[model samples]
Target: MERWQRGDGRLIVATNAFGLGIDAPDVRVESGRGGRDGERSEAIVVMPAGRQEELQKKIARAKARTQPWKIQSRVMRPWETKQVEWEKMERFLSGSRCRRIYLDSEMDDRQDRKRCEVGEERCDVCEKDDAMVEDGEARRAAYVEEQRVIQEQAAQAERERQGPWVDSGIDVPSSSRNIPVPSSEVLVPGSVIVTSPQPFTDQDITSSEEEGRPIPQSQCSSVSFDQGFAADHDPVGESRMFEAQKQQRSQQRWRVEADSQREGHEVWNLETRLDSW
Candidate 1:
């Protein structure tokens, strides 16, 4: 493992299900499945490495057994058929041409038909003769710089998209209008400008209740998003709404009901808040 860290030992021999979402940046030896998330990685198969033949025989017998080593049919992602993807895998490991070209041919997944280019991610076979690691490094540096510039441009666009800062339009009284607008049309950062909704005054509340009309843009009773947080004025918060003659009609009704009542009359209140004898 430490040899792998020193950029020497990158030959991983085991084949397992460990490449679904692996994010490691170092080289890996997968089962012909290079980095799925497009991170730079590699895969290798050692033909008759110094290991003994007895180890191979044990693994082969394990594969042929009826125990848990048996290969189960896995569900295909694109379809319901059980597709064994080992044929392409075998071709990629044994082929002598560019590793990328083999993958592109087998997968047929390239946007445009092009071979492995210099300075991009390349395999051991392509870089064996040239040995130009500097090209790949420079390409990565350019990619990082381009992404940073694009990110800054996107941020500027978002700020421009926000446009101008409009006032809440809920009237602020003359006393608290002390904070003047900033010099720049856009709001300056770190400037704490506090505002509140317009409140109903004592005279306004009294007049609204007596006139039997809704308080003009009450800032608490009801919320009106259209006028920027307009609230219905509710004095005393009793939620009382008197009809044009609801009070007069109630008084007259009780008077009629008590036309010839006794000295002590049992009073009952109706749903309309009218008293009856």
Candidate 2:
């Protein structure tokens, strides 16, 4: 045993002779017929299926030797210990309860009760009916697909809204609508061109010269200025009528302020007269 513990011998083979008095902490693995230290370890026992009858006969013989005789006492002690050890090994291999709990109970440790109190870390039998593992995986898959669909829909909407601009082959600036274009050329369909009635082309200039009629500059200038101002201030106070209306509103505001001041002065005069009385 000392030689095995010191690594001088890697293996030890004996028939029930090397079971006791061996306390090597570094001995991690043991393969034999029974349990060793009451710590976390694995024990593998290989026995023939036909040996059940032989094991039963041995147990019966050991029970019969329990009679109170001087030699029987000596023989019964080993048999009782072996019987108890065999029964514990049988329970360990039964697979009905948690292996850790069974091992702790067999070794008379109270740690099994602590494990029961927590009730989280359980054996295969306890976790066999758990459905959350599958349900969580399904929910994660559905969420991923939902996010993918939302992203696809947003991308499709963006593509549809920008389709016209892309098809026209023009790098449309954000301020394109405010840019002035030539009257002869149309940049977009359905756009209304509010040009002057008398076109200012070279043909019109030659026709006016030949007809000996000069174009009225004042009327043309006023119309062009009004059109440009209307474009700048569309939908709010852009007409000549709106300018007159704004003037009237300013006069009304002045009248209201003067009336309020006059009433305040009258109240002050009345308060002075009451104090004198």
lDDT scores in order = 0.54, 0.58
Instruction: Name the 10 consecutive residues with the lowest summed lDDT in model 1.
Output: 162-171
Candidate 2 wrong stretches, greater than 4 Å: 1-6, 15-17, 28-87, 94-96, 111-277
Write candidate 2's Cα lDDT for 101-204 as tens digits: 65566555635342222534454534542455778889999999999999999989967854543434433333334434434433566785555345377777
The pairs that clash in candidate 1 are 218-231, 218-232, 218-233
Residue pairs that clash (backbone atoms under 3 angstroms), model 2 = none
lDDT of 1 by residue, 218-237 (tens): 43333343435434545433
Top-scoring candidate (lDDT): 2
Which residue runs of candidate 1 sit more than 4 Å off their true CA positions?
A: 1-14, 21-42, 49-84, 105-108, 111-114, 127-277
TM-score of decoy 2: 0.28
